[model samples]
Target: MQENKTSFSQRLTLLKQKEVKQTLVGILHGVERESLRINPDGGLAQTPHQAALGSALTHDFITTDFSESLLEFITPPEVSIDKTIGQLTDVHKFVLENIGEERLWSMSMPCFIESDDNIPIANYGSSNVGRMKSLYRVGLKNRYGSMMQAISGVHFNFSLPEAFWQEWLAKLGQEANKDTISAAYFALIRNYRRYCWIIPYLYGASPALCGSFIKGKLTSFEFSKIGKGTYYLPYATSLRMSDLGYTNSAQSGLNICYNQVDTYIDSLRKAISQPSVDYQRFNGKKDGQYQQLNGNVLQIENELYSPIRPKQPTRSLEKPTDALDDRGVNYIEVRALDVNPFSQIGIEANQFYFLDVFLLYCVTKPSEFFDSHLYQETETNLSEVVNRGREPNLHLTHKGESISLVDWALSLFSDLAEVAAELDEANNTNQYSAAVEVEKQKVLDPSLTPSARILKILLENNEDNGSFGLNLADTYKKQLLATDYQFMTADDLTAHAGRSVQKQLLVEQQDMQTFDEFLRSYFESSTELEQV
Candidate 1:
């Protein structure tokens, strides 16, 4: 570990050189924020996705997640974090204006859901790809239950500039190429897996959830009750990322490798190709209707859950892994963030700044190759932080040694502060250092963390999770609606919706093959990675 620290320090010194420092200026980022649309009464809205918001299948900025009520807002990749966030905010403003009486739920957990049957699956229109998209969600509902599928999150997509990669290759006396770039990303992923618990520790906000989410289900957690229908863990951070939410038992045996791109792609390929006995009982179809894309461990590569993923932009009709196999990692998507209820956009600018610094640090640090034992250690650490991050004297394992979470976090921040300072210099702004400082306070005083703040608000008001979230929903709606668009106009957004509707129609018209053929071809194309 001391040797690794020395390597990181040497790399940081190299990055601080004038010639290499300017290469950091173009770091790109994007955001994908998901929220549920709720009625005035705080019940999940049963209405179909609004036509005015455009086709969920074709829209570039707005779409639905699992259920029709679960809206996802996307911003295109931008070099400027401020512009990226501004675009996200503009999209939220447009969505709020167009959704009529429905308010976007503020928390990562869903609002009051009556039952699984009440949550309508998203409809993506009549194209073969569209039907495939909807069917994928159907499979998710069948496998994970609609309640778990209703949970929301914020995905942060990040990538350093090409110039930085070139500089990095030069520093290592290696050729600038896809393999080298991809290897660097995988190394970053390994380090990210080791320390990602910090994300939940600082930003996790789902300490409590409405009881409706787990109405008749059995849970291992010893939850205490709050005001009417709210269940909570007193020191919990993100129950949304816990076993109660996105974390599940189905993929526990995967053991997917992240040490290299080839092994990673191969693992995903095997999962999709391998049939699951439990899922096989569904027989892939039911009474002449397609039950799922297939009865495999994963219907597609996207089904494999992870806190972070190496990504490449997919071509039309191409699978995610195939794109990576063909061109290497284009960026990385951080999937661990819970939707911040306090922000109208579901994320904040300072959070983006902090993520930039953390991700850069992950890349700069020396990462040891992972084995199954080390991988499981990372998993256990993340689970500990997700469930009981704010508990006094909490401990997590690091390099097979148990350490106080606060102590580990403060040590990490010391390194993060250096990376943050370099980023501030490159970007010509102090936001990155400021962001790290703010998060450092959360590490020292757990009460300053988002989860603690949320619990404090709920406990003070004697409010159920649903009631508290609804209040925030109302507040954000008013605030967003009153604020003028920063990066887009009402006319621009309306035109985008109009264009998406037309694109959806065009896709439907262009479909020449049956849905069966389309599904088969999609699976067949996924196998190309194995051949590669």
Candidate 2:
């Protein structure tokens, strides 16, 4: 177990590398309306009312479970393993047919880096806290390719029970580590996923909830109608952060390939099919493009669109048609993950296969990477990707070298083929090879990626979509909808203000409070929950 200290940043980084944790990669998949889709001609399709409501895809389902649970529960039963290939496609098809289902789901895979082969590790949750944001932005990191955390720097989840937390951690967990975190810990998900972009590791759980829910004791029962777990658990993972920088660089000449996978999406969108009668396609025609998505793999890519909004020019704008450049990626949102809607496994097997290749590609390249250089080349390439990631013979860069996306993907597919074969040897007689090959073909043919098909959908729907930025009005609306969550919502803020004015009414009644009295009365009360 890792010990805690008072220094905030120092302790946070250290905690990420703890040993008694069961940490694994978390793949989040969310869904809602495509209010922000643009037409093939590059025009918006969002209406005024919808834009005001917000355009980013909203989530209707959310779940997180241990990695072990995933292979145990979500995997096909012993008798069904042989048919997993075609049947798995049916799962993808089910999802595609319900694009605007207004739900969010997630699964966890029990995975550790090949490097962590012999190490018994811990999962420390993470976060930048109040000052975390500026550090990442002003400085550069992630050069090792593995150094940078995927999505949020502090990435993790938990598997706690609602009743258990109500009886313990929420009341005394943080108090036990008061000298370190200087706060109480609740076992729930709040102000995260949607707000407070930063997540911290407390017990190697998906950002083990860190704050005492003093008033609300959900001891009897608690659950999201769509989520799998009754409550969250403590995060418990550790990290290996180092200071050496500049390991390698993309070279002038290398045999790299760059193939966009856009075309694949188009083909799938035009030909989906599902065995479930409720979602089966109409007449098996391409006209119902969604049918194509049936059983098609779900590769989610959530991204922040800057809209070319630059901060006020430091020295004033030069003034020209170049005033606004296209927005670059703030962070890529990878969705398409299926929530063990029925359970809380981090992610599915097929999902992990794609994620491995994708993340590995993002972090490791022949050439060295820096925050600055990546922004310069990647932003340009991203446009082409969003525009045509699935196009056959697409181009890409590796180790500072260029290659065709088709050939590059083909090469990767070959590697995956070997991996599938290897996995088959270890498990069910290599029966899963065909199942894995399915997506490889999807990538090669350039007709299975979503961004590729969305082009036509936006065009057919007359794509003149719009979006909103951290809007006050919109945020307030979300507050209204989620009556329970808060880090001080606008309404709570006012209540807090009023409460402060009347602080004298508190039990202390003393101008200066005493530490001993405060500790006993508040934290060490005889409540069954607060037993430190």
Candidate 3:
């Protein structure tokens, strides 16, 4: 047997390495312990509902406030069916214009977050799924473009610059001042800077919009009561792709990410054009990635300047994952796909294989800045997935040329299957490949998408007229209520929360807790680095 004698730090570093390819896609919920309600006064109301937890850092029960009633209200009507590219672009514009664009983004990523309220839930990102499905009813099937604007959720890799934060804290004086809402203002600003501004009520209900904090004069309270780092925001990315069927599970999200997220980031970079940090400020890109309008040059502040902060990137090729944050590196975000209610979690063995392979593809493929033209095309894929997926023959732009959706999906699925098989063989886990084949068959078969079934039931909802979201919201609440509340012991928390869920949760939970508090004694209750 191999000698298990690695030192603690070495083991931690190794664990972090194992998590590199995983990307956090927060499994999101609209309502938590306290579900938010939109008061007629344009304020947010946090109902008594709250997500229960034994500690701030771990979760034994996964709960959400998103109600089925809400899901129905958000589902788009089954109209405006456009099938071609030109027609699709028009539909995309229609959705974006109506959606009132302005959203969040990640660094160097070209996606957007359109301003909308209440979208569908449940296996949302699979196969062009979600409340936005009705665009086809109007002959405006600009597939991906429309889906892009109808985003639902977000995931991120949080990087807190402790020293920069300290400087900011000093500037704010850690207390409410005559300037009014200075700390809160800056907190929101920080949230914006880190792409953490997925405001809870941005779509409709917002606690901050109506909470006592809005009325108070900023007493001795810390900003973390709202959340720790970043909160996963709803109405930002969840689009049920499964309903469109035929293996297009990521359409809804891919649309939102590439369309809304990408454009919004570009807009933001333009909005905050002043020099906050040059390219160098972003670490390994330490050389400062831009030139000032006045033609001045820049570079990152020396890493020694903020030893408490994550170490600055050492090489040009360094990734954000190399450094530590409240959460670790890019963690696995299993998109709730191939909604197998039989599994309760909606993911199946084959789906897991596909995920592993798909992740490997994302990592191995050239993710280098894809050109701007590709963004819209990516969005269109969602619509194609939603409306045309099951048709056996579909079209998509591949490497600058249009190709069949069936062909593309099949190819993509096959590649993923291969990767899963390789992973199994390498890990001595053939079961992984078996799972891939199982899911591959399911994808080939036309089945009910989670949203489809939910919407079918949603039509029966009495609250809203035609919204399919109520079902999902109810499901979320039900899941939360059903979650095992027996607080896991410390050991159990360690077992479940090593890196994956933390990455998933952190993407939505950044800027939730302040760095000072995040690094404080309260968080100490979680565990030492070794335990995670």
TM-score for each predicted model, relative to the true structure: 0.97, 0.27, 0.36
How far off is model 3, as Cα RMSD?
21.7
Predict model 3's lDDT versus the native: 0.27
Give the TM-score comparing model 1 with the true structure, all chains together. 0.97
- Candidate 2 error regions (>4 Å): 1-349, 356-383, 391-393, 429-432, 457-532
Computed on alpha carbons, the lDDT of every model, listed in order, comes to: 0.89, 0.24, 0.27
Model 2: weakest 10-residue lDDT segment is: 195-204
Candidate 3's TM-score: 0.36
Task: Return whichever of 2 and 3 wins on lDDT.
Answer: 3
Candidate 2 per-residue lDDT, tens place, 39-71, comes to 222122121111111111111111111110111
Ordering by lDDT:
1, 3, 2
Query: Best-fitting candidate, measured by lDDT?
Result: 1
Q: Candidate 2: lDDT over CA atoms?
A: 0.24
Per-prediction CA RMSD (Å)? 2.5, 25.7, 21.7
